[model samples]
Target: MAYCRCLTPAANQMLVLVSRQSPPYCSIRTMFVSTRRPHKALLKTLHASRRRPSVIRWQSQSAPKKRLLNITPQSLLVAALITGMVAAVYIWLEWKKFVHQAGGRIAALSDSGIGTLNWTLTDQNGKRREYAEFRGQWLILYFGFTHCPDICPEELEKLVEVVEGIDGNPSTPDIQPIFITLDPGRDTVEYMHKYCKDFSPKLIGFTGTTEEIDTVAKSFKTYYSLGEKDEDGDYIVDHTILMYLINPDGKIVDVYDKSAKADGIIRGSIKHISEHEKLRRKTFLPF
Candidate 1:
């Protein structure tokens, strides 16, 4: 139900005239209107004022790209942690290599205590520990009594500096610092523990029966002479002041005296350890 409003007054008059004429002219008018208009113009227009608007769509848009990996904050943190661990392991391996280098000069003062440094002494916890327990690590052997008012403490503190110096270094093997009492009668396990803790936790205090201590001292060529007890029952003891650096296989590598500085001890110990490692490798393999 649509009405055709002609473009001109003449066309409108002609349409009216055709309407007044017979059906043949009406058929011709229909054909003329049908051939010359858009579909919207030809649609039913009972409510012509309420015409709908035309719509258009485009077809060139695309989706966003896909990533190979979507890295989040958590993923970044994990990667950093893994990288740190790898670096730590690499540093550790390099340190081991440094400790295994073949050429370092240490003037081992005495070879008398070289092959004979085995003992089973009581540890700070009063536990019986064998000399073989310190096999795998380099030994910083010291023999002194806890009761010494001056020399023993002074020497032990100095020894601590040396052992800790090596310990703080990354390019070195572990050095196990040992304190064996020359005056075992007074230096009980509890006493030894208390005294050694005053110096360093890394210092392992050891004591045993008088006979056992005597045997151990004799093996390392260390001497101790006890003085007479006073009215209060307190006594004094004189002992050797030496720091022996022994290798993993219980062979003495270097000897340090009171004159030996911390740096000297560390340098000599590292060099000696490296040398012993080289020797061990040579022993097992012909090449």
Candidate 2:
């Protein structure tokens, strides 16, 4: 609200003005008293301020981006060291597992009696060869005759299973399963060949003169006795039932008696073989 008072001698008058409701103008109430007229520029300025609406402006500013990966030479070296430590730990764990699975230390032979002796005998192939020819090979030796009906056949079948078990593993060395007949007179080349095939193709049946057979049997510490003959000239040869596990060096490493099963023999063979490989590796040196 604005009031203008004009004070002249004969023309005395009062003027009232009302302006629109705006921020500064609506908040002001004033009375103007003067004998002179108001300036036009001042009036125009007041009118312009009341007619326009107030404006508030806003501005948006961009900020600098932060890095996701700050890679430096020191950081790269630390990462490599951590990876190397993890790899080393993994390798150590694997080695310990292998050692545990390979079984206990293999016992060394006290006497080399069986290792030194070599007997010339006739193989199933009709080839007369010395036992020395089988050197540098693993051997599983069993002494039995083909004529024995029950024990010999059962033992030979078990021997086949043992050999197959060893052969089934690629990491283990090959084994020569030797079957030496106590009665060589009856087990000729052809007869031994057929008999061995009945058990396993890997089996090698050997037959020789009584003196040669005696020499090997004595050296191996095996025993055998001939039973009374029957009407058909068939007699059972009572012999020692054992399997000798010999290493590549021709030394007897272990022996399995009658009570040992196929799985036991298989485990024992693998254990001994793994130990043999470890020993061989330790002894070998490349300069």
Candidate 3:
């Protein structure tokens, strides 16, 4: 027969006692089992299970998700306004720089009696016209002979491109293109009309006597020299390759040299036009 003697749990172990009855002897034995490790493991499992649901529940019930940007019409309009303001500021700075450079040259030209320069010449339509007749209109003036080999044609082509570019934009002001012949002996009214037509219909050609041409050229600060005649009696007239931009008040606003491109000239013209309008407004308001 075997009987349990004692079973007790201590601090970190459990004690088990047993008794056995043999035929002629009785025996007792003690055994020990570790309970602390298993007890701690069970406790840890219970705590983790209790904590898992709370964390998930809190995330689903109480935590708020971050909102992403929604592109509504109002947001788009605000963004457009910001972009336009930046562009306007940049354009204003550029316009200021242009004026700072051009103001001095224009002042010096005005001081040299250029502001009073006027001419009486014949237009391509065989009509006598004076330069003063073009007052109150923006003008781009070029001096070249109809028989120019290459340079005059190229410059006239660029000038036409610029004029068209300006006129093409409805918001921008239109510009009148005037071509004054440096070689009046050959560039007659009919020849000037044909030459101007070859470039652009908007171009108006002018021709006058030697004294009238010289006076206009000098007043406009342009130089020209006739080259030696070739075997076929064809001569080249070398002159300044520049297009003068004049405001409506007959004052020079800007000068585009040979290096100026059509797009650049168009931009410069628009800038000058805007500035001129602003000045006119200030004159009326004086504010």
Candidate 4:
């Protein structure tokens, strides 16, 4: 039998304390372990197990870090695109609103600014007739050339009838019939003088230089162009067939086209004139 030695845990602890206090040669080594009862090995294993629990706690505390509110490049790109689209839509809506408001303002300005009624031109008698002179009278203004073979003559005849009708009706404003020639190159004062007499004694004719006529036409928004000239330097003139009705206050209150009839002009002129008179008397002042 092999020899072995062992002690109880309390005895072994007492012996270890005494061995530490004594010299190295006095330590009893054979009593520390036994094959049948290995208490020292068991104690070492228990201490290692305790250290393992501390490592386990460290692992639990340092578990995979959770991602809270994490942002990636792809997510960032998507958010930026969404924000840009929303901003573009908002800006576009505001731009449309601004354009709509501007369009309305421009239309209102156009209506008030175009076809104004302030101009001066020389009449057939070589006399200057300032537009202000006819401010108090109702103006029946026509723009055409004496060379107009059919439309001008017929329109002027109709104008004569209108004048005669106005003369008979005292309710209407005293209408001054005017014929302004668009063809300054062909029509002279003598030519228009003859043309007016053929229509009515009450009708007055007006002619001016080419530049003056162009200025008046532009102000009135009358369209006219010289047609192809013949070998003899004569050409037909293309123009807008329109007649204007000027109020006593020198404002263009109405216009008539070729399709307009006598009754319409008569009724419209009378109505507008009566309305003006009513307004004037209502706001009348004595100076």
Q: Return the TM-score for candidate 3, rounded to 2 decimals.
A: 0.63
Q: Distance (Å) between predicted and true CA of 229, model 1? A: 1.8
lDDT of each: 0.73, 0.79, 0.79, 0.73
| Model 2 lDDT tens row, 67-156 | 999999999999999999998888677656655544222323435465458788999999998988888999999999988878889888
- Pick out the ten consecutive residues of candidate 2 with the lowest summed lDDT: 101-110
Position 194, candidate 4: lDDT? 89
Clashes per candidate (backbone, < 3 Å): 0, 0, 0, 0
lDDT of 4 by residue, 1-287 (tens): 11233457655522231122223233333335444465775456445645542221122355797889779999999999999999888867765664455345434535775446566777777798777888788888898999887988989888877777776787765789999899998899889888899998889998889998998888878899999988988778888888887767677767789898877878877766665564455421221
How would you encode candidate 1's per-residue C-alpha lDDT over 1-287 as one tens digit per residue? 22344555334211211222233333223322333444453343323423533233345578898998989999999999999999888867765665554323232423444437567989998899999887788889898888788888888988898888888788778788899998888888889889989998889999999999989988888878998999999898877789988777666766788888888888877767656765666531224
lDDT of 2: 0.79
**Each model's TM-score?**
0.59, 0.61, 0.63, 0.58
How much is 249 displaced in model 1, in angstroms? 0.8
**What TM-score, to 2 decimals, does candidate 2 have?**
0.61
Give candidate 1's error at residue 72 in angstroms.
62
lDDT string, candidate 3, 1-287, tens digits: 22232335454443332223332343443444355444564445445645543221122366687779888999999999999999888867776675565566667767877636777999999999988998999999999898888899899999999999999988777899999999998988889888899888889999988888888988888999889999999999989898999988889988889999999999989988877775566431224
